[model samples]
Target: MSDDPLPFLDGPWRLSMGLRRLEPDDWLRVDDAHDAQMRLRDRLLAERRAEVAAALPGSEAGCAETLALLLEFLPERFPERWTRDGQVMVDRRNGRRVALDGEPPLVIAGRLVQEDLCLMRKGPDGYELSAAVLCFPSHWRLAEKLGRPMAGIHAPVPAFGERLGPTVDRFMAGLDADRPVWRVNWSITETDELFLPGDRAQRAFDPAEPVGSGLFLRLERQTLRRLPQSGDILFTIHTSVRPLGDAIVRPDHAAALAARIREMPERMSRYKGFHLMGMPLLAWLDRLAAAQVRVAAPG
Candidate 1:
């Protein structure tokens, strides 16, 4: 079995909530790619503000509370890189001092961390997407999802309404402020570009290039925490990508991933663009798995 903690690596990939309790200190993650990702976020916020950030009329209080919670949590979680001085928060990694006022609170919060921040508030129907600063959406648009409820926002995802909708709603409804949770979702793509707001039909893999050369494994680590004051769930998505070639180093992992790709439901395969990958990708994975097995066998 692979030593990787990522659930998807284990394989026969299935869609489920799969949420785990999140330690308060581990709320935000910072890594080597922080500088580059932050720069991209800054550019998007400045150039594509309307596309990346939005809030409903009455979501101001929730937005402000979300920002306040982050301001208190970030410095405490990552003291070395993040420090707050009154309304000005300093990021030592890029030497950027962010003023916590004037601009929308969600926008300011998005600039401080790698995760795209989203606020979900309880409405008559259910939890609605009240506000968000979604800089790196995988294949969806922030504009389309804004002001939408849980089920409505995920309407495009196949079987989501029938299979996972009610469970997600119940979980969101009962989520406690002190106890937060996190889960992961993954996808395969041909590009490493993070800003993907277009439809899945736009994805195309070149036939000439080697199957493994440009393939990428994209993972989104999502966290949901109910704010103590506003009772709004602060949803955060931290996206990371790795070269597919680098992910299948171990024989077991390679085999598991291959089985996952092969066994994925038809609709999901098409939804995730695995059908576009076609036989070439599967053949490549089989070869990689066999090679890894040979290399790992007893000398």
Candidate 2:
């Protein structure tokens, strides 16, 4: 029923990958969406600063100065290259990338200066391209796990659903006529355990893709609750819908993406990816909870 070229049910891997990568046209469509988001954030930050300044209008106290002073006492007090203007020149490390804005730009809450900041880079078409993603770490991880990284991914945690609709709209609008659009979704589960099956963990794996062997283990509800309390890990899942050889949801594709995610006893994120692609809410949770169970007790 949907006119989308990449049907919600199937596999044109190239198209799927393209959806994740932003195209030039997409940028123009979502330009305002991104701008509005940045403006709103700048306003809030400015207001907060004003409120603090109003509270201590005459006080010369400076948090940055105090932090710098404290850092000075450390044995490895190497000079950080902060500009005279207060903008921080933090190294663009391989880990997570954060963006900051005006004034003195420094790391705040493990993110960059500008929360909604985007990056434009040269693409194969010889044109500058842009894409927006969720917050730093989440988007960073998603980008790394995918076959092709998101041209731009930002999720302003400080701002949630407020920007999701606009962000997605802009992303969709920018799709290259030669590419497929990606479907992105997120959810919060009550349980702490998360798992991505070896098969599902690898994005490129197909049914014919050599299947890994494993057995389903049952875990008690009480046991599940105790290992790690709720709110332990923030589960963020990203997927792109592609057209497969014989596209049909009846193969239980929806139920597949909803597979349970359980914390690997020894690993931070390594877990089974139950492909419960399009299942309804309640059913998906039930399967996720059931799919993931406490590791079998040692002898």
Tell me, by lDDT, which candidate is best.
1
RMSD of each: 2.3, 20.9
lDDT of 2 at 207: 38
**Model 2 C-alpha lDDT per residue in residues 180-231, reported as the tens digit of each score:** 2233332222122222211232342233321211112111110000001111
Which ranges of candidate 2 are over 4 A from the true structure? 1-21, 28-39, 48-115, 118-254, 260-284, 287-299
lDDT of 1 by residue, 122-141 (tens): 88879999999999999899
Looking at candidate 1, the ten consecutive residues that score lowest on lDDT are 1-10
Candidate 1 runs further than 4 Å off: 1-4, 202-204, 296-299
Q: Against the true structure, candidate 1 has what lDDT?
A: 0.85
Q: Which stretch of 10 consecutive residues in model 2 shows the poorest summed lDDT? A: 218-227
TM-score of each: 0.94, 0.23
